[model samples]
Target: MERSVIHNLIAALPVAVVAVDHEARVSAANVAASALLGENLTDRPFVTVLRHPVVVQAVDAVLDPAHVSLPVPDPTLAAVGSGGYRNRVIISARGRDIPAEVTVSALPDRIGALVVIEDSSGIEEAEQQRRDFVANVSHELRTPLTAMIGFIETLRGPARDDAAARDRFLSIMETEAARMNRLVMDLLSLSRVESEERRRPAEAVDLTMIIGAVVATLTPHAEAHNVNISLIGAENEALVTGDPDQLTQVFHNLVENAVKYGGSGGEVRLELSRIRHEPALRGPAIAVAVIDRGEGIDEMHLPRLTERFYRVDNHRSRQQGGTGLGLAIVKHIIGRHRGRLRIESVKGQGSRFTVILPAKRDRR
Candidate 1:
């Protein structure tokens, strides 16, 4: 191919590519390569442009006269021959170290070598998340598992002859087991929600009805704790496209949380309205706010409320049987519905959790 054509093809590649001559001087560098390694790489030694010792050594091996005389390996292959050639390295870019997969291939006609750099940032992030998730899950499960095992041993030995002690230990054991069960269920639910987040729900749902049902279902629990649950605003039907089951879970979790934590304030309100020109929603939307009158959350904790296993008061959260995945699940469900979830709270005053869904366009 013509030199210009080759350069154009290299420029179009998503990964960074740089071509070097027999002396390891850069002959052509694509746009990605320039952005990563800095511009003005033409005629610059590969060692200076790449900086990484492993990459420079690979380039040297590819340009070696002994290998150049032999038939050049296929350029289509991802990496050069596997003679302990380092194919991965960290490079500094835009003031940050970026992990990249470097592949060196011998150029046809034995002119030089081609260096391909593939950014591995996404892969690294995913791997880190997997590790963190496993660690968090293990820690969460271990606490309850330890308690259950201790109680079992007591019931088998020390508490065996004491009926009252055995009963109490059994009750404690049951609660611990239930907590573990809830945690596993929440984890599974979160996994499912994340997997389906990219697919928009096609079914039309009534926002008002879902809210009313959630309120009615939780009213008794609220009453038991002296909290009055009420649905206010938007008496008319508010329609939107979403998954009804998931929406129900979203409202249920929010209201349950309010009753659990805000019941001391004596009132939990569900407000609905239709609004246009909201900045976050960016269009017409049906807004549902789950407002509580209890002691509100701190400003610092608000941002991380949707994070998995995050809690403001860990002891209180555990006592309340919270899995710490409620808000995370709600956040994902709203996102899947092409909506937004916003939290506004004033310490010692109250907090409001709002869900905004795009309003269904009128077909008539």
Candidate 2:
């Protein structure tokens, strides 16, 4: 392949590639580099454009020839840092605020420097998410487990001789056991939604039917909370093509949350409608909106509401028996359906969660 062809191939490989001259001016860039670092980097210095503190340090280290060795925190990003002629640095980029894995290599016979950038934001974010998940899961599980253990110990050691004491301990144990069961179920549901999201499942499901079923299931919970949960515009069927089980879970999560977290005795409404214009989709879309008359979400926290294990109020969420995975599961399910999830909230009024899915294609 010619030089342009080679550059094009590398650029097309999803790795951001930039070559800098001895004077630190951009010698060449691949398509990925231009797209990631911006389209205007042909004659600019790589450092001046990227401006990541970590990258600057790595490039300086590679060109110095005096620094014998330097460290790159991540082993995957260590390839460039280990070599004297080249050093790899993990840096956060401006505008996008994305962390990139970059490798800087000096050309043979001191020609110039080769810089390769890879956006590691997804991988790094996933790792951090895993750590947070483990910590959250551990803490969640420990609460009920500790309570059950203490109750059991009291019943077995002293309360064993007293019927009244034994009865009280058993009652407490039941509640703790129930709490544990709820946590495990939510965790399993979250895992199932995430695992199945990567592969698209084609099954024709009626939106009205799914909404009705979810409402029926949550009726008792709604009644207990003195709240009304009902499906609106259910007279006509709205069809959506996706996994029924996952979609049902999405509906259940949203409705159940309305009862649990929405304001006391407020109305929880579910509506199914169609949108002719949605920028995220190519054509007409099917939209499902769940409106709640509860204490709404803060505008600032709206963007991060879908993050796993994220809570608006940790103490209140735990007290209300929430696992904090409901919204995250809703997000993954919508993603599996190739849809968009939008949350609109007002501090004192309420919240409306909208899920927009592609309309089923017709065949003659």
TM-score of each: 0.90, 0.79
The residue pairs found clashing in candidate 2 are 80-87, 80-88, 81-88, 263-294
Cα deviation in Å at residue 13, candidate 1?
A: 1.5
TM-score of 1: 0.90
Task: Highest TM-score: give the candidate number.
Answer: 1
Q: What are the lDDT scores of the predictions, listed in order?
A: 0.86, 0.77
Residue 190, model 1: Cα distance from true site in angstroms: 1.3
Error of 2 at 321 (Å): 2.3
Segments in model 1 whose C-alpha atoms lie over 4 Å from true places: 65-86, 278-282
Worst 10 residues of 2 by lDDT: 80-89
Q: How many residue pairs clash in each candidate?
A: 0, 4
Estimate, for each residue in 326-345, the C-alpha lDDT of model 2 and write its tens digit.
Answer: 78888988998999998999
lDDT of 2: 0.77
lDDT tens readout by residue for model 1, 94-148: 6789988888887776677788889999899999989988998999999999988
